[model samples]
Target: MPDETLVDVWGLAPAVLVIMVGGLALGLVVAAVDRAVVSGEAGRAVVEPLLAGARGLVEQRRTTLAPDRLLWRIGCAAVPTLALLSLAVVPVGGRTLWSTSADLVWFNAMEALLWAAVWLVGWGPNAVHALTGGYRFLAQGLAYELPLMFALITAGLAAGSLRTTDVVAAQEGLWFVVTMPVAFVVFVAGAAAFAFWGPFAAPAAADIAGGVTSELSGVDRLLVDLGRAVFLGAAAAMAVALFLGGDAGPWLPGPLWFLLKTLAVVTALVWAGRRVPVLRPDRTVEVGWMVLVPLTLLQALAVAVLVLNGFYA
Candidate 1:
């Protein structure tokens, strides 16, 4: 919100582009690692998927009956766009571009766009499977998204500021994960949900015949998948910044510490994907409302109490 700390408007677009490419690449690697674990394949599984995605560069786009090509394309485009946007506010160590006083709010809003982007992708196809997938994402969003927002709020409250740099600085003495374990856990669950990874992947699952992606092919499909991975990476990076004492360590540079922490969180999520069972779409709602929402609310309240009592100070 403060002009002194905001990203330069002229430099913002270019920074977003550069970060998007790097983030997307890192996201693919994290996803590849996770995929290999889940499929019982070699660690080199990233190779085959890379080749397949490259082939998509030349693969022809497929169409569904009565499809709205414009809306569908917008949906495809939005996936990576939103992923790129998420990193704009978050810092790498203490360095960042496009940050603001309300960066936490900005990040959350960009992520909320996932629901719209996903639903549009599903709905534009005009098929039973795709439509159902779109609806499923909406349901999933309602369930997981609220708690995610609350978790971010809890962090913001603890820091006494909504900016990410402040959040990182607040963990100078101790990490938020130690003080707010419930919120951290809920936030991790929300990250998996944001990427629609295992245990929260109903919208894109095989049971619904690949759900929203049933009608997708070629590079559009590649981008869509990569976008999901990129989103997961961004969430991991934010978790590092929020809960893991961003860029704080003995030997490593700040950026290296940040990178290491992000990878650790992403790896944990990938491992969870291998071990956790998928929650049915119906059950997702029940758990989200009955379990996640109340838990995050209590987390925030607890942080508020601690903050008021100078526990963090």
Candidate 2:
């Protein structure tokens, strides 16, 4: 409720805490939605995630011979750590934790770090399946990463600044989605791909024996799974911030509006993504290069023209 438009350096600690807690809460929401969709039991959605977390807390760690313990633990911890770090540049209530001139780049950098973290997770287990899964993730990344970059860059181009707050402000007259719908769709789909959720889950597919998570157990498993969910949730919030005019709804308090829009995005993403059959990693690459790359580039070009014509003004 405090003026979110003002950057409060003194309140930075609390802001970080809030983002962490809220991010985790959103993760839970994402889990619940996916559960409900998969099982067709609305009641189980809320109860199952909590029960799973509780079970994970007490479960014994699964061990493998010759595993890279240091890298494994570091990779597990970094999943959620990088997700939270990416949120630092996102405007929770019209103010970011740190105001950087290139907030968009900061967020993208965290995502790139996450790519390495996930590969490390796959390699640390030393199991053939785990390594395969890790490599699959890398392959999928090669497919989705460029289109995702263009999607983010498209938003930054329209705003004429890489700062997220400025991007949100530029939507005062028209949400970028109107001019850049392909970027919006590609952006959200890219989030699911990077998180390995729904259709883009080839890296963690059953064919590979749970893939990167094949050897994980107890707290390690929990961290990786929780990290995936949190990353998806954060991406949904970002989609809203980038394309839906963050906190710009009529008559509602800004933070509340932002929260509502974010929840809607997370729910919709889960519901829609769940129905698509998971693609093989190779085919995912085909679609990424053959379909998405060209589409997103064209979307960016159109936006650039709009920017040049002063349509935003």
Candidate 3:
């Protein structure tokens, strides 16, 4: 039985690795596309200027905003760096790089750290807009984080383990979304808000004139932008793994199914970015904490009761 377990684990390893790498690569590609192909105005933009800006940053002279430049650079770079590291803990395609019975909890905790790093980045810059952006991010964080945690806990209670692979397997007949549709919706909203995408993208919106990113330029700006895309992809992938049964369908290989699901989520994010109205900061704060949080908690209680009653079985 141990040998069979090892073999099954080994078989799943490559697919997990591919998904992780693909998540990172997709992030960079999306950043490049955003810089080059997609513009805020939505028309009369081309990729050449974007590539030129990227190339110019590499060739241009470095500028310093602080006397202690090294710390500043580290501050801007650390968030995405840590966020990418945490993505490894998230399960994809029936496995993670390191699997633990408590992996789901660990994954959620690390994800929270990603937000901490974002606050650090904002504080590091020492600029007014950056500071304001950072505080806004924290406010938004408070609004969405509880719902996100409750959603994960709901899944954990339903699956009877904190292992993400077991969560996927538990949905063999029907995805959790089918039974816990409300929780699923809350999770997606929380994920999107945490990612700072679509209607929740107020911290980085153009009206704020690139709020957190306003003062950033050259390679520093590139890294920040790239990191945002990476976070988006990672969040979407986690959503797929947790609630969508992580490549459980037949016919196609597990990895392909996983990619398809992630793509769908990504497309939704991008479309929302284009269509949704940016929420005012006050309204966002109110809705996030008051409405979303209570709804998610209620869903968690509902799921817990269902699981206890053997509805999941």
Q: Among these predicted structures, which one has the highest TM-score? A: 2
Model 2 spans with C-alpha error above 4 angstroms: 1-10
TM-score of each predicted structure versus truth = 0.94, 0.96, 0.84
lDDT of 2 by residue, 160-228 (tens): 989998899889998888999999999999999999999999889999999999998899999999999
Residue-level lDDT of model 3, residues 220-302, one tens digit each, is: 77666666777777777777887888887789999789878877776665665557687766788788778878887888888
lDDT of 1 by residue, 99-142 (tens): 66788998998888888899999989899888898988888888
Per model, state how many residue pairs clash: 1, 0, 0
RMSD of 3: 3.9
Q: Give the runs in model 3 whose Cα sits over 4 Å from its true position.
A: 1-20, 29-53, 56-71
| lDDT comparing candidate 3 with the true structure | 0.70
Number of the top lDDT candidate: 2
Candidate 3, 243: how far from true, in Å? 1.1
* Model 2 residue 25 lDDT score: 89
